[model samples]
Target: MPSDYHHGVRVIEILDGVRPIRTVETGVVGVVGTAPDADPEVFPLDEAVLIIGSRTKAAKLDTTGNGQGTLPGVMDAIFDQIAPLIVVVRVEDVEDENEQISKILGTVDATGHHSGLQALLTAKTSLGIKPRILGAPGFSHHQPVADELGIKAEHLRAFAYVDSPATTVEEAVVHRNLFGNKRVMIMWPAFKVWDTPLADYVYQPASARALGMRAKLDNDIGWHKTISNIVINGVSGLTADVSWELQNPVTDAGYLNANEITTMVVQDGFRFWGSRTCSGDPMFAFESAVRTGDVLADTIGEAHMWAVDKPMSPTLIQNIMDGVNSKFRELKNFSYIVNAECYLDPELNSVESLASGKLWLNYDYSPVPPLEQLGFRAKLTNKYLVELLEVK
Candidate 1:
């Protein structure tokens, strides 16, 4: 429903390149119809099919030597029952009409739902009728049009952007209230987390157990358990973990038996959040895709323990940190966050103008000092320094 056409295309492309992805079909399919005469259903559906058939047959003399095919009569009955999915656009509004159609098709591309239609069209093209294209999300009126064209409606996978309807005014109000002009990036992992020293040190036992259960479900349902990452631009971003509870009562009941077991699992959820500001840059328009790619790269790097098999060159990280800090300062508004321990590193301290009033987190690690605790110091991490001309 939302503009997801490009994303769907990307998904299919990536999966096709990597491996043969198997997916179970879910939900209902959409219908289609096409017509040249005035139709009622086409009034609402802009992306509906419009088939312009010819009625005049070619002369026998023309066909005798040229092998010309006879033209078939155009049927007016095609418009009778097939609703307004295929509207007769006036020649005058061709530009506006095409723009709307393009937008819908673009949405389909963004969401990765165009594969079925693409396949259908490919098949139809092989038979000689120049394949007419449809948008990713199928509307109710389009079913008959598809039928008239002899294209199977089942080839379409109908999926709306927002599935759940708002039941209460409060829910709607809350949803609207939280909306803002910002960008968001959502991420899903590619592999499951089994064992890692970082998990042992950073996460609690309860957290580890929850991850284990998730991995198990991923295995059962044939979904990958790898953790994903995301990065958002055009708006300041915030990160948080989210989850949703889903269960099937019938399958859940079977768990009570000794031999039968069931686990009511919660699906992990992630959402990129930003305000909806019209003035935001084009990056905001592509925040979802950009962030997804960034996060995926980050997740892969993180999983590899930052080693990445590359030589232990700190140059890239150092350069990124330096560049980000420099840009933050140049912006003259946003505050820069820095880890103080990084400053003490011999490589960073020597750079001229590097130590300016940027915030820092204090950390100390030394084998010689036995009594002094070595970690982030409250003096640095907890305090902020106004930007001054000098580092001190």
Candidate 2:
């Protein structure tokens, strides 16, 4: 505080205005599942344990050859795509299959302990990172579990990848009807990979592969980029033979994508073919769009901690506005947003609200959506030949 009673010559550096906001990583995956053979000391029941770019101890996550647990194989699948931070919440692997579903769904005990999907809520507080990408791998195929995942994703400003039954394309469409949420994307069939532990080929859930793909896209590329069309590695084949045609929409791959169920396709090798979420709303159809919005909102919101409880002044208000606009430009340069503008509206910030030290800053941004379709009319005409004849 500068007072009138300040004696001689003293300098007060006024620090108020736009400061670059900290950008949170958008690729941290929080997965919930069983790890029957995992060291209980390492991955306690219902505790959020962080694993960063290492699998020395991850081997302990399962030793029974992926027989009882889900997390072991899923972790391997995610690591196959890209090494990103993973927050695992392990639950008890019970005898009853239905009990395993309940465990994966998790519960907040009366003592305030979080388990299952609920354990992800404490990821930020306990592990200093929030998982913006989430999944349950084997368990997410269960409708209730997937719905619960959607609920948790909304709370954490995260996105969830859910698996679908591999029975048929129609079954995948029916699975899509089981859930509809912008935060949740449904993946169909499963990916087959060589399981050295079992000396046989086993299927991994599409949701688990999606988790890895998303992490790679966010880390290697910008978060605004789409997860589709990228070549998937460490996969031999898909459990279902998803047909795909470059210029046709009447294929199995196209049908699954049309119904908002993401399926893999074989191109040069195998590629993730779909970009749509389970959302019925066209506005949030694409996972890339949802993620772009999440990153912007989370980064901007977390960056404003310095402004809290500070004296509101014109300089401070201007600083806030400029900070947001500047961030928009930076993100636009990185292809995170198409374009963005920030402004203060008098209608939103009323005189009374300002008097009460509340000011409303408004900004709008358009996310870069995935290119699902591209078309150029192939007109067979003499027009091009006429030009060629003149040149000759």
Candidate 3:
């Protein structure tokens, strides 16, 4: 019998490539709240982690009417306003409200248990995703929850959209005074959502809606655009109608603004009418500036990941600087930033530091500030009479 023989050969190709800096994904929101038992079909609920991709999946996991129903409502609000990617972290259900709050605050030991807010803090390790925006929706009103989220956002280089615990404008002003973190944006006076089953408009935290609006803003315009003055779509109405006059500095809204709290008002529609962070520092007062800085830091960090193990040399430093400068040039061209530059100072990056395998990079960028105020001057003049005489 004749035997058939075959010869096998394999080819391998190696390509040298430099990974260019990329803009991190914006508008991805990380939500931590309570959910019913996990549906194996939708997501591994038992794992207490889910990255919802569609409104249908969100509806399936909707816990809108449960005791802790506001979580689903927040999710629905986000979906209604804008279709941003949502990462849901479902906490363990406990009967006691106090115990639940403690669990969410991460006060209780999470060993062999599903930690609530702690889950979100460790989402990158557990779920393989990092959200640019973080919120607890219904829970953000709680001081502890808001504080924890603010700390997380600051540490993770993200933004925290929080709601004031105040039910009235007056209370919101007081609550706003308690916060002063650039990473946090406190929204006041929840909006009314029409409940289908109850056939009534129920008040819900505006943080969810604000996050959705910010996501929409980032998607529609660049991230540097101010989130204020935009219509908050998919809301029946604000819980309370705040007048434009009252929003002035001498009024409640003004005080709230001083404390870094944003409020919505009834205009042509329910509009997000403020844009400032809780940071007491005037340098980072504007939310857009804070956000732009965060985006730049994240983008630069990601871009330089490849330089970690490479030998530290002048060429390596120049290459890194060139890449970052290129990105900043694009951003400046897009008007996202006024100007930006990257360089290494000889004093900062000394021979000792280079010998020790340490490199120093100086990055400076002027973010486009929001036009929060405008002034007009009027004068009566007779120039029109001269022009008319000349014409005659």
By lDDT: ranked, best first: 2, 3, 1
- Tens digit per residue, CA lDDT, model 1, 25-128: 11111222122232234222223233332211111112223211110000111111111111121111123544433322222456443322333333233322
Deviation from native of the Cα of residue 275 in model 3, angstroms? 0.9
Better of 2 and 3 by lDDT: 2
lDDT for residue 111 in candidate 2, whole number 0-100: 98
Clash pairs detected, candidate 2: none
Write down the TM-score for model 2: 0.96
- Candidate 3 stretches with Cα past 4 Å from truth are 1-19, 37-52, 63-68, 93-95, 107-114, 245-252, 387-392
Give the clashing pairs for model 3. Answer: 38-45
Question: Model 1 residue 24 lDDT?
Answer: 26
RMSD of every candidate to native, in Å, equals: 27.0, 1.8, 6.0
What's the distance in Å from true for residue 197, model 3?
3.3
Q: Which ten residues in a row have the lowest lDDT in candidate 2?
A: 59-68
Find the candidate with the highest lDDT and give its number. Answer: 2
Compared with the true structure, the alpha-carbon lDDT of candidate 2 equals 0.86
TM-score of each: 0.17, 0.96, 0.88
